[model samples]
Target: MFLASSAKPIDDNLKNFVDEIEAQSPSLSVLAARQFRYSLRQTPVELNIKEPRQFNVLEEFIIRAAIEFQPPPTEDELASVLGLDSVFIKTTTATLRSLQTLSATSPITVTPEGRSFYEKGSVPQPPYPIQINAITDPLSDKITFQSESLNETMINLPDLADFITIDKTIADIASLPLEEIQKSIQASGLALHIPEEGKIVASCKVVASTQKIWRKISLFVIFDALEDKLSIQIRNGKQILESASNWLEVLHSESRISLQALCKLSTEAINFEREAILKQKNTEIEARIEKIRKEALETSTKANNEIDKSKVLGEAVQLRNGQISLAFSEVLNSAKSQILIYSPWVNQAVVNEKFITLLQKLANRGVWILFGHGIARRQEDEDKPVPPEVEKKIRAIKTPDGLPSVQFFWLGDSHVKEVIVDKEIYLCGSHNWLSYRGDYLPRGESVYKVTIPHQVQEAYEFLANRFQNHAQKLWENALENRDFQMAVESLCVRGALGMEDIALKEIQNNNWLELLPVWLNVALQGLKSKNLPGDSESFKTALSLLSQVSIEETFIEQLQQGWRKVIGAIAINNPETALNLLSDEVWAQFIRLKIVQESDSPNDFILYRI
Candidate 1:
């Protein structure tokens, strides 16, 4: 059930890609993304190898003949009895005499070594500690030496619904023809040396136990808006394989066609997720609203004169609707450093001429205001523009330094309502500051006011963080966010993927010393594409920067190959410049490329390199 299954092992890169797609109304929408486990049948197999024992076949045969004979046959008699090859018999006897296996006399006689070898029945047999390469593909029936031996511990059974129906049966690896297996093993690129004759598959036993394991694949269902067609891309391990070719080959036709049904299921899943998220949010909002209403009722029933003024800064005080407006005015007049507010909506009823005058006075006094307002349940309402006059009035406020004092933000579909003054006083409740007309009958609107230092600061920070998070989401370019390191890493990836303009622009403008790694990455990718120009300076720059980082040997080798490629290209024209660019340290390792000057043409050189 991994097909439309909700469980997907998402890496950070894929998560960011999905988030970006969700952030905008891009033409391409991801319909489905999940891991599809592929079951690989691991059947145990036994393989054998032919190895040299203490003696070879011919030597053992001669010794056995001499020992078994009634009179212990002479060399002439033995050769005549065997096949009448006297010269061959003499040569073999000479070798045996050297090994102390036969006497140096005319007739062959068993020496001590020969007697013990016959008595012990020591003869050519399949070599023990067999060098077996047991890796095989059940589908293709191709054996490989690259894989480790399969064991019982790696077995896993798949649910009927989870795995694709494989058309092929488990291949009998043990029953395969020796020649075919030999060919397959050779193709695996292992440096296995095979004898010219008698390269035997001494024994092969197909073990009864078989293992089944699953491979996790990341499946992304894509919709082409222009074509009005649905297609799929799958990440099997590290590779995002080309469509249809690897898919049909691995999963078969039935599983390939079943992907079309995912569009409906994925749509329903997204809707379900949205509704669930909204339900959780509404529950929290309702709880906060109810708490405010309950507090308002309690406060309204009590006499305002009875509440001690000295206790206000030490604890929370519930305020009635009228007191809420009075507290807001007090915050505006008494604020010293900063003011932060969150209201669900903005209207002329509250943000009137008097409110503007109070806000302006605070700005003149050097107090900064951060204001956010927006709330909606529907898409159309969320998209509705803010009141133009409200925005203009808020925008007019200026700080003592002549910079804009008011930082205005529109919180999308938010339900939070609070105000924090100088990180000292906080007011949070169900009352809307700007939208409430204050003419309605007793509606139990309440505001919770607190002046505890920690509580006020915590509330202020929470609201501030929310605004920053929202701003990041609203940012048009992801790379422009505050995280410079992440932005640089992303730029490097993009540059490596052939978006050279971005890297080039950054390089031309910024300090190259800090971006050497980025330059190296781009050069490496360019080398892979085989599209780098002979005169390009990127490769040379990357090579010069290699001493700065501790790179892997494999990476250094690849970089060296790239350097040779660039040098070869450059040597075709301006050979002297290419020669000058080559460092002695790298040149020693890359001596395969030799440039020789032509006698006839003084300035001309011929180059040969790999």
Candidate 2:
């Protein structure tokens, strides 16, 4: 509804033009009044008239302005000439341009069609004529008409004059009921037969001219009385055209039919039929496209499934740090029943927080987890203890059953790093199974994953058996060792007094050095035992007290080295082997350091300094 206007400023003459239109037509007075107000403010006016009659009035005003202006007018000049609002003039010009009645450039001029319609007072001409033939058999109840030139073309008109016994009835045709006339004709003996109820039969030979060539067409005209419409069907041809019933009514008048109106109606009918056919074709094309798309999608899905299957069964793939981590997580998440992981190194930093949470979730869903790491083979390896953080995380998992869903085992001889999920998928390689720091170091690793059921089952069984055998051997050796058995029993005593008695008895008997290995073995066992709360604080305190003793630098080095060896053995979660590495002298000094007589409580034994 926005108005556009010429850049020219408003003048006094524009105000006079507004007064003239306001006095001329009431239908245009509102626009004139709006223009007068805009002229006072020297601003462009806005017009929003929507009624058809109002548009006709506005069109007439524009035509008058076009005639008055000599060299085409600016929007303001035209508005001034017509006494219309500048905004109304702008809107009218824009609409005329869209209709191609006015040119679309500055200094707007009327188009040729506009000149004909407005300046010359011309009207739209039709494309063809409506023909009528004289009536025959006038005296009969059923009146018939035959074309003057074509005898076969006939129209069986209703005999209203005969039924009513009236004379000169054509003048009163409007008063007569066409339905009653139809009934009288149907009852008459001379009534021409029609195959359908609504159709009236007629035929004519039409000559259609294109360029200079004229083609003869034999066509039938059928009137549908129910719908009040007429259809022209070409004889022995598929093309059918329809027109309004008003065309036939014109023929019933004393005047000749308006052939121009009839031709326009015929063109409209043909255009409608073309549109329907186009719509049907579009629908068919869309359905075919949808079918093709669905087929393509189904084919693509099948091909992708085949590719995935091949990848799972193919040879091992080399992977970088990120790739290996992704592969491990993918395999772990896919586990349905159980997962077995074997790696020599395990740490909270390496295993990462995400993997830990994944383990927790899997355990909540009843998936069993078994982890194994290699036992320390050298004293230097002892520095790698089972990270206390990892143990705390494991303890935090609240499963349905009171027992932990995860189990840890130490591998004495094996160094293999692998992951097995559900006993069906196996991932084996140089990649560390538990700990992988992505892109932090230039480490090259690769792992192969296969779904070969036999190899997977064999690998799973071998690892499980190796862990079981190691645990059995450790248990048997612990039972055979008398000193180890006594140390474990003494460490199990709960009270301060019992700790004092054990510490004093060992130092007095001069067997405290033998007690050192046993005590470390018991501490490691406590860490790994599901039911035992790891007494790390006590072990740390005992070590600190032993350090306070007046031992030589070499002895101190041995003690520190022994401590690491025990921690490394425990890192692999093997307490029994860690105990075997401890010496008798180390254990003796450990007890002697805690035998201060000045200590008031048994727990105070650990608080004593040298």
Candidate 3:
């Protein structure tokens, strides 16, 4: 969600803007003034063609210099402008000549006099008539902007309407068989979408030969603008059974034309999911009923199994009081000569640190332990990305299989809690993994992921459906190749559709937004992804439900209280929500942030919907 603001770099006006920020919030003044002085030049760099780390250092030095220094046109300014300390400047300077390339035309190069003045600690005043044009497109991997011109317009990606026409043409095209489409597109492809009136802007293809198993070629159809809904001619693997409108069928008034088919697809997906959640709930209730019945039946029979039945009945009574661990131990102990562990989040923490040693010792004494957990992601970062600090010394362990192990797994929708040992050893209550959460540093205490064997089975089911047993790649924008992020986008935009419809239509084709004229703020924009988990989508749903005024306010509020919180940035562009961020006189910080440069700016950044 990078915004590109147009420039209104009037010298006196710019001076006044700087003066005001500094005067009102002098500290912010130093920080905010970078928008006025520094020029941002970004270009994509593929790994193959590279000049090593020269431009990397230069760019780092500039942003670092800009952010760190006060009244920063000095050596400190250079450091702040780049993202490093001054000690590296000499090496950076030596590398600059070998590094700098003017794909366009060379501007004035920095001379020794300029370097000496900066080296002598005098602020180098920026030359007047600052050249503030943004590098809208990258000529190559590395981009360098002149320090003088700091204000210019940045172009944005196109919308849905621009590239596709689905009403007639798309329907006709998607109707093709797999083989011909593969030959034409030069791959095996799935044509999943068609906009009602626009072009067939987006499509996905499967690489025919040597395509990795389960590997898919995702063709993201980015539209020029938001249309009401696409009218599509539908097909289900073989026959032209129906003509479904590829439209936004306002379920409760969102958008889209084809509601019935969409609903059908979505309902099926949701049914599969809901069955898993509800199954345990229903089974537990039935199991309780069955236990009482069995006890009555045993007493009625008065057979030799009477004592065993009474013991089982006695055990069942303890369930209401929650003696899960006792029950689990009983189950394990009662196992004549066989035992198996079915946990998704089993590590030292769940059973003690001596748990493994104990298990291995037990195994040597003839106990079979069947332990299971998903493989850990293989990462190669020498200096691991630091996790936020907590008082607890959390360290991951290497398993015998050469995988990092942790006692954390999702309960539902990628939750971070656990169900342990069995339905018996339950350890769940108010516990949170957060250390420096919000203003309350190390605030949250233990908010446990409830532990029960049934719950564990439920957790395993959810994980299997979602994670695909593979680690997600680390893409730059997160939006780049982010199939998961695309899911998030759908959850936000499409509201509460059945999981089936959500995946089939919303995610499979349209949700992935493309950045048009990609050179603009690739790095800064890429910084937006956070591993903030939980359903911010549910929040959106709650808000929509509130807008409908369908239920009592108190009821909604109560639901929210129990609702789980997730760590994801609120979709910055929810029309109802985002419209608030766009009222008159909201441009102050944007100006300071270089997001909006001119006061007379009629909003340089425009979001297109298709």
Candidate 4:
């Protein structure tokens, strides 16, 4: 759009380009690579012409003198009257006569055309023809002229074509500003003798135009990951465009599919690299483990001691790559109440069939799993895509109640690699437990594993707060995208972090009353888990949201029943607020009839005669 000429054919050197990128920055790597066509519009227009004045100063003076003289002086007399040489005056008059500005005979007289020309600013030249083709760059919304239209072969992918459809309206010549038209004309290499200060566009008009022609431009999306940081960038054939302000705005406005494809590409690339690296290093790692076992066995035999079969260490210990892997596996398997993980990336390589099976088992045991991944430190780095395959598999794991046990949320900005299991163990380090496979090249990666309860609890709270802080942003984005399931997941995270009021505020502000059934279910779960207080602000807001649910609104019988039960539960917590909100008749029916009352346990409520 900035008029950098058309892009050449995209090169097939993507792999080499990625290799070069990784070489320059060992921590940065490309995940996926694809080339797609963006659109540009070309419009043909006719420009009306305005020529510069053709007469010289002497010539104009002589012509004016002849027109002023009452008798219309002869060429010789005109020369004398204007105080100019007769030879020069005669020659100038001959040229003017040829141009029909003066009579061809001996008299130097202003013709009808010459009189009009003199009165209208004394111009000597007639209008000439000017027309050109202008093209609009969709990205920058700038119009420019090209000698010929872009000739790139068009692709036929309907989805991509639809994605690249130009939404900005292109202004026609009539609608275009005069200065802009002139600028495009000048850029097209039109020869105009008139100074720019002169009215160049006053004589111009859009005589004709062709239909808008759209052409393709090559574009690239790149992902960078280094030092636990992650970012996505866009590039053209020339260079990275994310650095350009205009292109940055375009990237921000690009469709979610376009951006998701970029993230998918980067993840694919990383997965490919991870596979190759592990394939080469597995043998060496196995051999090293075998050697360590042999040494331990030999030392134990000499001391006549039994080697401990349980590898679970109850004290703080530093773990390298192999130890980190074993520890991650053990933590996932041994977790009884919860599992908290913070990694900037996730890949199928780590979450394979075995991992999926373990997650299912953990879900069955009701171990709450929270996985927060993102290291986008800047504003531009937010809204990254979670790998589709990874997300699908994780979300597939459900608890006995048919609800997801794992909650995945974007941290937006976090570099800490940690895994806390059941407040009994904490792991933190440089190693990416959910993403990285040890390199083929020997590199040291370590994480400190601590069993100290206070230390583990502290780490858990830190990671949980990260998810809560970013949950609101994710919730808003999900609602905007109409991703209801993700929206629910985001709110669940807030509930888990004891920020139910924030979640309720989102529901109230976003007009999410329809989701109240699910929200109340989450609230019930929180109460059961002993996380939410009976008289918390969350209960107060719940009563307010319930007041807004229209009585005339239609709902499924089951949902309506669930809604009543949750309302009764809320009354059990905030009885005065519920009485003040609900109709007195409704309260009497619920209380006087014993329809909703405390069961054997005070906190537990049952619906008796619904």
* C-alpha root-mean-square deviation, candidate 4: 20.4
The runs of at least 3 residues in candidate 3 whose Cα sits more than 4 Å from the true structure, single-residue gaps closed, are 1-234, 238-254, 258-305, 308-398, 404-407, 413-610
**Which 10-residue span in candidate 3 carries the lowest summed lDDT?**
216-225
Candidate 4 C-alpha lDDT tens digits along 1-610: 1111112122354555555655654234444444545555566555555443656788778778787777778877766766778888878787788656787786677787676666655555545555566777655556776545555454652333454444556676568777777777677675552444232433446444544444433343333322233344445544664433344345445633353443233344445444443232224323433443354345445432232422332335566766778878887899766678888778777777888899888877656688878767543575645678888999888765456777875654555577877667787777877777633333588667766455556566656655665566578788889787877787777765666777878888888776666677666655544456556666556655554556555533334555465556556666554444445444433343243442322223322211
Q: What is the lDDT of residue 75 in candidate 4?
A: 70
**What's the CA error at residue 125 for candidate 4, in Å?**
65
lDDT of 3 by residue, 132-229 (tens): 11121111112122223333444242222222222332222224453333243222131211212111212222212211111111111111111111
Better of 2 and 3 by lDDT: 2
For residue 239, what is the lDDT in candidate 3?
34
Residue-pair clashes, model 3 = 69
Q: Quote the lDDT for 130 in model 2.
A: 29
Report the C-alpha lDDT of model 1 over 1-610, residue by residue, as the tens digit.
1122234333333665555553543224555555544555555555565432466666677888887787877777878877868888788878777545577785678876456545555433333333444554433334555335544343242332344444545446666776776675567764332433323344556655655655545556654332234455656555665642355444533444454343234445545434444454445555554554564455546565634543463456677767877887887688765677888787877778888888888766646577877776442476545688878888776643333556666654567688887667788877887788746456688778876565666665556655544433432243445454443444433332234444544544443334443444444334333434545665555444545434444344444444545555556655776666666654433442222222312122225642
Which candidate has the highest TM-score of all?
4
Models 1 onward score TM values of 0.39, 0.27, 0.23, 0.40
Candidate 1: residue pairs that collide: 1-162, 74-107, 75-107
Q: How many residue pairs clash in each candidate?
A: 3, 7, 69, 5
Any idea how many clashes model 2 has?
Answer: 7
The whole-model lDDT of each prediction reads: 0.55, 0.44, 0.28, 0.59
Sort all candidates by TM-score, best to worst: 4, 1, 2, 3
